[model samples]
Target: MSEPTPLQTLFDTLPQSGSVEWIGIRPARGEAMKALNNVMISRGTGLEGDRFKGRETSKRQVTLIQKEHLYVIAACLHREAISPDVFRRNIVVSGLNLLALKGKTFRIGGVVLEYTGLCHPCSKMETTLGPGGYNATRGHGGITARVVEGGELALGDNVQACS
Candidate 1:
């Protein structure tokens, strides 16, 4: 049998580590609750097109399968983390070592989300940040997570990770 994928491994290790803090969580443009509700009701699905394939063809269309995927939290550098395009994450966290969390799961505001895979840096992020953004953090800033247990999340809530 073939070995399990990285995501599989991650799932196997559950309630790994979790944390939460008060941070700004906003919906991206056209990602308002109403919009998401419309899509969910109209399409009966939250995911949209192919995230990687449509990158070249349709910039407007979300290329990733997990469209409307919420960024529970995002971290950015106040000054040192600057780039031409803003690496604006929905939730900004500090004191948590994301690298260490690799192959582990973390909970935010009581809502558990598995770190399925690395949020790879994309050209769009480079374009938005311009030259400075390309080399910033050596492409370390990418935010992607899968919902393990769905629930209402708000800013300023305590985030914890279960061992």
Candidate 2:
């Protein structure tokens, strides 16, 4: 076979295995999401209790951000570190680059999730992160995912490539 592309090589190696540092599920729009130690997920239910649950048309079944990216975003705005909740992502992992999982499948605890695309920053980030919050979080917005398998995801779960 021909040599793999740089990204394909990284995908094959995946030297970075990380843990799920935080989890959040929003029950409804315009409301604060619930931070939890564990949450159930499935292809049909997405993240249990999440407002986006059962929305077949939606590809944004879950959202993830890297814990280290929080600092990067803060520095971009000349502000202190922000919490995962401020970004409204479902999971915050440390170590692995969320972008690396694009077009790949990964497991968080027992759940299988496929990276769909980048989780771009929304206008709410401006209000939540302050004047420059939205812009600061632009590239650090993290990744979006869709559940492919049903299982329980807990805090400190080992997240790694499926194969």
**Candidate topping lDDT:** 2
Off by over 4 Å in 1: 1-85
TM-score of model number 1: 0.49
- 62-139, model 2: which lDDT tens digit per residue? 899999999999889886877778888999999898887877899999999988899899998989878988889989
| TM-score of each model, in listed order | 0.49, 0.92
Poorest lDDT segment (10 consecutive residues) of candidate 2? 51-60
CA lDDT scores, all candidates in order = 0.38, 0.87
Which residue window of length 10 is worst by lDDT in model 1?
37-46
**What's the residue-level lDDT of 137 in candidate 2?**
90
- TM-score, structure 2 vs. true: 0.92
Alpha-carbon deviation at 136 in model 2, angstroms: 0.1
